[model samples]
Target: MSSDKPQNASESELPQAVPVRRRRWAPSLVWLIPVVAAVIGGWLAVHAVLSRGPTITISFQNAEGIEAGKTRIKYKDVEIGEVTSVKLSPNRQSILATAQLSKEAADYLAEDSRFWVVRPRISGGGVTGIGTMLSGAYIGMDVGKSAARKSEFTGLETPPIINADLPGHTFFLRADNLGSLNTGSPVYFRRVPVGQVVGYELDAKGGFVRVSVFISAPYDRFVTSNSRFWHASGVDVSLSADGLNVSTQSLAAIALGGIAFETPLADNAGIPLSDRNFILHDAREKALQNPDREMQPFRLRFHQSLRGLSVGAPVDFRGITIGEVTAIGVEYMPERKDFDMTVDIRTYPSRLDTLSRGSRISGKLSPQQLIGNGMRAQLRSGNLLTGQLYVALDFFRDAPPAKLIVRKGMPELPTIPGDLEELQRVLQRIVKKLDAIPFDNIGQQANDSLKSLQQTLDSVKALSDGLNKETVPQASKTLEQLQQTLEATRQTMKADSPLQQDVRSAAQEVKETARSFRALADYLDRHPEALVRGKEAQP
Candidate 1:
């Protein structure tokens, strides 16, 4: 009994032999939760690793509205990437943004791809990105056509004036200066807006401004090889021989500045190739002028005053513009002992060729021969109100003989006095002749003569006074006596008066006696004649 108790106690304390049973093992609910979670987590990790796109770094001048994990990269308003991180570059001169793009955008990470930050902005192009004011700023991308892939890019400070996908043609213009032109300045074709200035920069030589302009489709076809471009920035007001001319593209152009291009009617409008360069003239007048080829420099020296005559004055031939005055100067002539106003002019002989039916002046007639034939340059008033003067060339039949001479490597054309100058000279000569007259001597002699005439007039006045005071009464009495005598004589002559009747009877008797006497005389004279003519008249 003691041994059994010890074994049982030992068995109970050590181990107990149990029968083996084969049963199915199942996982607990708690294990299921944890195992399912682990599977799902592994799946998500593999997906993230496999579907991830390329990471790119963009360097910007400023981070601006960019925020890591908040700012999105978008192409055509669709989100394509997100900014993963933002940090300063090693030089601290720019902000570096690391972006993670979707797998779909990986293939478009080209070398020339453009990126910019979109925000509310107003430029000459008008308001843009205005929705960003409420929706917040985002990265804008313009996919490039380059085949090479790139992981780094430089962000643009401003949105591009033109979109890469926009259908247009880009042209380059070289200008001496940028006159009030901005990036979004409008370009006009026949005063209609067809494009905008995309970009401008100084040329490599820094001699001119190179402007890049993009003309939209359809309108781009109008830009031909012979097209002329000029600034249409403000109102162009000019006065010419025709009249006052005022022109403007539009009110907007007058404010924001603009450019205008036109293909001349007479020119061949050949299509220009890609990346063609054009010259931007300062004014439309200059852009449309016929190109002067083979310019001949000539000088004209005038002895008259050169007032109102300025450089750039038109040099015309019989009302046709053939050249312009390039320079004006004064030179002292030792031989003439006077100063001569020198005008340097550039003339296009081709103008004459066109006018003379393709007969060139230099080929047909020498300048000397032309001058000998009385070709002369004379200053003429171009505008009476503006007092502007232009050089006029014409045949002067009465002009003094002259010759074409060369001095200082420039052909000198002889000049005749202008009409105004000749009139001034004539007046000056008349004034000299008037000055030569003895005016002082004439004044003295006239004074003496006036004194003698005054004395004679005084004597006549005294005689008239005497006649009125004394002699006039005596004369009146005598005239009255004479009138009385004439009245008596008139009464005696009337037949109605007795004395006059008796005189009339006496006169009648005297007349009868005289008639009798005349008859007797006549009879005696007849008898004498009869006696002299013999006895035939006796009866």
Candidate 2:
């Protein structure tokens, strides 16, 4: 009731006028802490999304030394990425390696980019990746110049011979076979290694093997249009007209094989185009031989054995090689009732034309005229040690007259017997003559003669013995008597011998009588009466 009544106006107004004022809300430091932390966390999330790189998968025949989360991809020994995982392919035939690369390596992932597992290797280019033996294997990278990007790739089984970044030129070589050459096989210019074989494949027709090679610059410029390439593998040992020849590029070529090229000094060498195609010869001599412009086929019929003579045997004119034997066969001669060896040969007339520049022939004589003038072919020994034979063409003034015969389409050239064959014929004739002699009859006659001689010798010996035993003593006694008689006669003829005195006295008496007769004759000449007188005295 007192409230309802009008109270004291000042007390009532004082109680109503005392209005309550709400205190302003105050902030805490704890709220500021959570707001700052949220801003930092947002910045970190955006940075992580921007820093990640592209992922790539590579296929390999095998993952021999590859490791996940451990092996790294390197370019020129610089780390560019890492292998994250390894697994088999869907076909279960190959291994697939998943790698994460840095952003800088994204451009290197081109269509032609090459990758290989680096391990210790010994090849024609020498030993490489030895450092990887201790550090473990890694994926090697070679960046390509292709503009198109790729995420999947097939890795190389072996490292590339030359890096893509290396300045060089590529060329193609065609060969009959691959020989001992392989990727990374050395290529030489005058035995100096200037390049390597990068790859090889068979031709579309499968008739030949085509090899691709890379020549480093400076040396690449040396390969000209006229340059000749040949296999320098192992040792080339040949016996030709020049004699035995042994050649090789290097010791490496003997083991791993190699190739060599050279430009002839006589040829003008122009710059070669990129990817130029050239023939790869089997030997250096064949590569350097001058091309023959003219070939003439001719046939030769030999009546003797063709042993030691081969199809490629040289056909020589005097001492110069002018052709080669192309074919060898046996043909039966119906007229002679015997078999004759037929040899087809190819002769280069251009070689003779060049050699006859200042000679008397001067390439003017025809084949018919040459054959008419005593030209003939003969087989002779070329190499005594190898028992190799060759056809020799020369003038045979004593040979029987023979004409060149053309049968069917081939012209036949005349042939004379080989020296050995001629000698064999002479020996056979001598043997036949010797065989005609009656050796057994002659031997019997000789034995009879020896018996007669022995009888005569025995008779002579018996006679001599008889003379020694009986006739010799009788002859000695006769000789002694003759000697005594001769001594007596000698004594009788001495100056004091009685017979000599008698002869002297008789001779004196005869001389006196003759003197007396002479005196009487003189007296009778003076007187005729004295002729009748027996004796007359001289005055």
Candidate 3:
């Protein structure tokens, strides 16, 4: 009976079981696990893109329009990469453009590819990229794959070469209107583009312009030592008559101008060129290196007319420019006591070097050409209105062989004749002579002669009246005296008579006085300085 009661209690206990409920572990944790995993995976994907290629940081002096991710770089007009980030360098001297290059750009990236900001610039050489000057463009590159210089991708402050590279070349030149010569200006050879401008810097300290020119690789060897470069962009000098001009040919070209370089054909071995870089030139040294050298700078003192020419004028040799004007001033002549201006000339050194100056040289001559072999000096007109003069050179055979003459300060240059100066001097001398005539003395002499004639007529009429009328005693006496006087006057006409000789001598004195007076006046006019010690005044 006790066993049965225990079994029923056990069954009743089972009926007192528990209700079904959620455990302590959350069911939301299943969805939360997946959420955390997704966040981590998204972060990993971004990291992969960031680390896709080699990191390159390009530093520039300025970063006006550049922005990370916004700036893109193109290779052969194909978009290759975008900037990843922008940060100031340690010293704050430059802006570092960190870029994340794509696979293609990264593959072709060589040691020589260049990077530079596309910013507008203005210079004395020229103005450039004026159309899009307000909104700058993306960075540009000249991608090159080469064995040389291809170690790593390090962004350069200088721009890369856009055109082909030149092998062996060197050109010396000046940049006047170079404002347009930016990182993208095109370089032309015989009007055909073979190179491009890479970079530029203002060389204020050097007194010259610094320009980086890159010739395409194949043509690189063609550029030789006998070359010259000059800015071809627009330039305004405020000329007296010529108006404003504009030169726009390329995006990289200066808005005002571009550069023109020449490589003269020569068999001689020329200078070798490494990679392209900015060239700083000294104008004086370059002039000395030119092939056609000139005579050393010499001054020619000119007292006579040089064709009425003057300063800033061209000095020509066979119609080619050879020299320029330096100065012109007058100096006193001790003998003539007059002033004469001497013209100074500055000839090109190259032209001077070739001249056998002062050496006993001989050559053929022609009267018509007035030029033969020896050096001849002449005048050139620079500014017609200003009457500026410059010295010019010519060759004459028959003309006196010019001898190099050295003076105390600066040697004078050779000079030529001028029709204008000759005419002017002749007119001036004539005027001086005319001004010296003695009109006052001549007038007094004429008045005296007319009075004497009048008196003689009056005396003759009185004598006639006395003869026609009955003679009064006083009249008779006057007539007798008159007759005696007339007889005496007639006798005085003889060279020997005492009274006649006196009158004759007085007339001679008058003639001599007129001549002496004229001579004195002429002497005073020609030599006015002598007037200070002239003869004593006549009473």
- TM-scores, in order shown? 0.68, 0.67, 0.44
* Residue pair clashes in candidate 1: none
Q: Which prediction has the highest lDDT against the true structure?
A: 1
Encode model 2's per-residue lDDT on 113-205: one tens digit a residue. 999999999865678889988999999999999999999999999988788889989999999999999887889999999998889999899
Candidate 3, position 297, lDDT: 54
* Residue ranges of candidate 1 with Cα displaced over 4 Å: 1-39, 57-64, 67-69, 84-98, 149-152, 205-207, 237-246, 265-275, 282-290, 301-311, 327-342, 357-362, 397-402, 407-409, 416-539
**Candidate 3, run of 10 with poorest lDDT:** 360-369
Stretches of candidate 3 off by over 4 Å are 1-186, 199-205, 217-221, 226-271, 274-290, 302-388, 392-405, 409-418, 430-539
Q: Where in model 2 is the C-alpha error above 4 Å?
A: 1-51, 177-185, 199-206, 231-248, 266-269, 298-306, 326-344, 358-378, 395-417, 424-539
Our model 1 lands, by Cα RMSD against the true structure, at 6.9
Per-residue lDDT over 122-147 for candidate 1, one digit per residue giving the tens place of the 0 to 100 score: 87657899999988999999988799
Clashes of each: 0, 0, 58
Give candidates' CA RMSD values in order: 6.9, 9.1, 24.3
- Candidate 3 global lDDT: 0.61
The models' CA-based lDDT, in order, is 0.91, 0.90, 0.61
| lDDT value for model 2 | 0.90
